[model samples]
Target: METNGTELRISGVLGRLEAVLERENSLIGTDARFDITASNAQKSRCLYELNLLMKSMEPSDLPRAAGDRLIRLRSVVETNATRVKAHMEAVRDVTDLINEAVQAAEADGTYSMDTFRPAAQ
Candidate 1:
């Protein structure tokens, strides 16, 4: 079967996105810090390229196998997206808990009225 330039580019971008997501998943699991700014930038570029490729492509022009492959890749992307969202929520929850703890400690400090002396009325 013959493949067009657009299809090739789309496949390449999809592959790159898959690789990025895998790396992100590994980092998230290990509680490791990664340069998300750079990763997001790369993902954005790949998505932009994919959008351009799709815009120039016709649905009927896609081979059956390529279409199936795209469906599978879409599933992977969706799953990774869900994982990322869950991770963000977890991070937010932890941050909120830390802030609450700090506030509680500050409110219970040794300088409270219970520890202070009062003058006779």
Candidate 2:
């Protein structure tokens, strides 16, 4: 099969996106702090370019290798999504714990049972 310019461009975009997602997956649950904004931006740009390229062609026109690469990319994306979800959940749990601690510390206990109790004899 003769590889055309469009096929090459699509393959390049797919590779870029896969690399970004793999990097993101690696950093997601790590102890070191990692910002995902750059990764997210790169992924978005690649997807946008891929979308434009794909819109010009039909599904049947896609090369077999490109299709297989897309499938592999899909798996990487799914794994990245799962790791991101777990990371977000962990952040939320920490936020909730901090909020609870703040609320507890701020309480004056004015409504406590001891406040309404009779004076000692």
Point to the candidate with the largest TM-score. 2
TM-score of 1: 0.74
> Mind giving the per-residue lDDT tens digits that candidate 2 earns over 10-104?
89999999999999998877945678777789989999999998887889999888899999888899999999889889989999999987777
In model 2, pairs of residues that clash are none
> What would the per-residue lDDT of candidate 1 be over residues 1-121, giving only the tens digit for each residue?
2376666766788788778877776675465668666877888887888787777567897766668777887777787788788878988999999999888877987546656667657
The lDDT for every candidate, in the order shown, is 0.75, 0.87
In order, what is each prediction's RMSD in angstroms? 4.5, 5.9
Quote each prediction's TM-score.
Answer: 0.74, 0.82
Worst 10 residues of 2 by lDDT: 104-113
Error of 2 at 2 (Å): 9.9
What is residue 106's positional error in candidate 2, in angstroms? 1.1
Which stretches of model 2 miss by more than 4 angstroms? 1-3, 109-121
